[model samples]
Target: MEYSKHNIFSKVKDSDEYFLLNPLSMQADILNSVEAQRYKDKRIENQQEYFKKGYLVDPKAEEKLFKSKYLDFIDERDSDEIQLFFTPWYTCNFDCSYCFQDEYTNPDEKVSDAVMDAFFAYIDTQFADRKKYITIFGGEPFLNTPDRRASIQKIIDGANQRNLDIAAVTNGYQLEEFIDILKGARVREIQVTLDGTHEVHDKRRMLKGGKGSFDKITKGIDLLLKEKIPVNLRMVVDKDNIDNLLNLARFAIEKGWTKSPFFKTALGRNYELHHCQTNNKRLFSRIEMYQEIYDLVKTNPEILEFHKPAFSISKFIFENGELPSPLFDSCSGTKTEWAFDYTGKIYSCTATVGNVGDELGTFYPKVDLKQDLIEEWEERDVLSIPECASCNVKLACGGGCAAVAKSRTGKIQSADCRPIKELLELGIGLYSKHEI
Candidate 1:
C-alpha cells in the first residue's frame, strides 16, 4: 500500500487544524499536524481509516481501477446547454487602455443582413436538436447608434424567432438608448463593466478623447434595472484598481443597486491571454488574486454582496457536502462553446475569437472546416497533457485553458498549469469556518 498521489494538504486559518483533500477520489478529512504528517509519509498503522477515505491504495489494482473510472468519467460526461457567441463587429466607443481588439480591427467593418441570415441559417440547422443560447459579443455589443441598434434588433429578432435567449456583454456607456429596443425580448442578461469608482474607472475605461465614462455607465445600469432587465455587473481588477473595489461596493449599496433582484455580479482578473500587455506587471496570477480576495473578504465581509470569489473546491464542499466529479478538460472551446463572426469565420472559444490564424473553419458563402485543428482542440484534456499525467491537481485544474497554453507555448497539449494546491490551501483557510 502507498499514499494516494491525489492527496492535498492545507492548514486551517488561525487554528491548529489541517484539511486533507483528494479531489479525484472525492474524499476530505480534517486532521492535526501529526496526523497530516503521518498520512503524507504513508506511515499508516491503522489501515482501515486510510483505506476507507482513499488515503492509501494498492498501487497495482486500485490505481488501475481509478484510472479506468477517470476514463469512464471522460466518456460519460454530459453538457446540456451550448453557448454560441456572435461578434457582429469589433468596434467600440470606449478606448480602454487594455483593449485587445483595437490594434487588429477594421474601423469601418459592420455586419450586414446577409451575414446575419447565413448565421441564423447555419445555426438553425446545426444546433436544431440541441438546447442552446446566443451571446452577443464584440469590441462592444451596444454602441448606441441608429444603424448599430437596427443591426442589434435584427440579431435579437433572429434569435427570438428560433426561441433562443440572448445575452450582451457591453461597456454600458450607451446602454440607455438600447433599453426600449431590448424591452420584452428574450434577454438573459446584459453584462456591464465597472472597474472601480468613477475616478478610478474612468482612468482605465474611457472614451477616445479621454472623457470619463462612469456617470453614463452607472446611469445606464439604473435605467436597465428600472426597465426590469437583468444586469450582470463585472469588475475587472488588477493591482492598480483592486483597492477601489470596496469603495465601488459602497457606492453600489448607496445607489440601492444591491437590493435589486435583477442585478448580479462577477469578478474578473486582468491577466495575459493572447499576449502580454504594457500593464502586465499589474496582473495577478489566478492564485494570487484569490488570495487577495480572501484577505479582503476577511476584513470587509460586505464585499460578499458585491462579488463572491469561488474559493475553489473548499467552498463547494462547504456548501454541497461533497466534491464535484473530475474535470478532464476545463476549456469548453469546441466542446460546449463556439465563437462565430459576421466575417464567416469560426473559432474555438471567447479567448481566441478575434485572434488571427485561429480560425477553425468558415460557415458562410461556403461551408468548410479544418477538421484536424478542431479535433486537436476537442481532444485536449489532462490525459493528453504530459505534465498533467503526473500532477495530483490535474482533475481540479483540468490542464488550464487551451487558448492560453497555445499562446504561451504554441502547443495546445502543453499546459498552462494552475496552482490548484496553493488555491486549495487558501480556499480551505477562507471557507473552512463556514463549513456546512
Candidate 2:
C-alpha cells in the first residue's frame, strides 16, 4: 500500500490539526498532529481506516481506479441535453465601462427570416435525438424596439412550435415592453446584471448616451418579479464597485428580492476577456475577490441571506460535508454548449462567441465546420493539457478557462490554472470549525 497521488495535506492555521483531502474520493479528514506525523512517516496506526478513506491503496489497484475515473469523465461528453445559445443582434443600448464585447461593432443588423429558418433546420437535423433548450443572448436581447421585439418573437415562436423552453441574458432595460410575449412563452430563467446600488450601478451600467439606467432597470426587475419569472441577479465585481457590494446586498434584502423564491444572485469577477475594457486595471484576481467577499461576509452575516458566495472548497464542504467530485475539466466549451451568433457563426463558448478568430464554424446558410478547431476545444480537458497532467492541483483547478488560456498562451491546449493550494489553505482555515 502507498499514499494516493491525489492526497493533499495541509496544516490548519492556528491549530495543531491538519487536513487530509482526497479529491478523487471526495473525502476529507481532520487529523491531530500525532496522527498526521504517523501518516507522513508511513507508520499509520489504523491501516484499515486510511485505506477505506482512499488515503492508502495498492499501486496496481490505484492505476485501475484512475483509469476508470478518467474514462468516466470523458464519457460525460455524450450529454443528452443540447444547450444552444442564440444571439439575436450585436447592438446593445448600454455602454458599460468594462464591457467585454465593447470592441464589437454594433452592426444593428436584423435577424432575417432566412437566418431563423436555417437555425431551426440545423437544430432539427443535428439535435433531433437530444433534449434541446434555447438561451437568448445579446447585446441586450430585450431592446425596446419594434424590429428587435419582432426578432425576439420569431425566436419564441420557433421554440414554442418545438415545445422547447427558453432562457435569456439581458440588460433588463426594456424587459417591461416584452413582458406579454415572455409570459406567453415557456420561460426558464432570465439573468440581469446590477453592478451596485443606484449611484454606483448607474455609473457602471448606463445608456450609450451616458445617462443613468438604474430607475428603468429596477422597474423592469420589479415587473419580472410580479410576473413570477425566475430571475438571477449578477454583479460584476471590481475595485470600484467592491465597497458597494454589501450595500447592494442589503438593498436586495430590504426590497425582499432575496426572500423571493424566484430570485437568486451571483458575483462575477470583472476580468479582461478578448480585449481589455477601459477599467481593466481595476479588476480583481480570483483570490482577491474571494478574500474581499470573505471579509464582507464576516462583517455582515445578514448578507448571507441575499447571496451565498460559492467560495470553491468552502462551498463544496458546506453544501455536501465533503470535497466535491474531482473535476476533469472546468468548462463545457464545444462539447455541451455551443454559441450561434446573428451571422450564423458558431463559437466554442459564450466568451469566444463574437471574436473573429475563434469561430468554430458556420451553422446557417450552410453547415461548414472547421473540424480541427472544434477538435482542439473538445480535447481541452485537464488530462489532455501537458502542464495540467502532472500538476498536483489539476483536479481542483480543472485547467482553468480555455479562452483565457488561449489568450494568454496563444494555444487552447495549455492551462490557466488558479492558485489552488492557496485557496485550499484558506478554505481549511475558514471552514475547519464548521465541518461536520
lDDT of 2 by residue, 1-436 (tens): 8888888787765578887888776688988999999978989999999899888988788768877887887766575476889998888999998888878887878678888888888888878877888999987888878888888999999999999999999888888888999998888888889999999999999999999988888788888889999889999899999999889999998888987898999898988777776866798999998788767766776767777766556567766766776788887788778899889998987888889899999987799999998998988888789998678677777888999999999999998878776666666665554432
Tell me the whole-model lDDT of each prediction, alpha carbons only: 0.83, 0.83
Candidate 1 local distance difference test against the native:
0.83
- Give all TM-scores, in the order shown: 0.94, 0.94
Off by over 4 Å in 2: 12-17, 37-43, 431-436
- Candidate 1 lDDT over 1-436, as tens digits, reads 7777777776776678888888867888888889867766767567888777787777776578668877777555444578899998988878888776766754667888888898898888877877889999998888777888888999999988888999989999888888888885788899999999989999999998999999999999999999889999999888888888789889998899999999988888887876667778899888778888878877887787776667666667777889987677788888888999879888988898878999999887777889999999988888888888899887788888898899899998889888877777777776765433
User: What's the residue-level lDDT of 377 in candidate 1?
Assistant: 90
**How many residue pairs collide in each prediction?**
0, 0
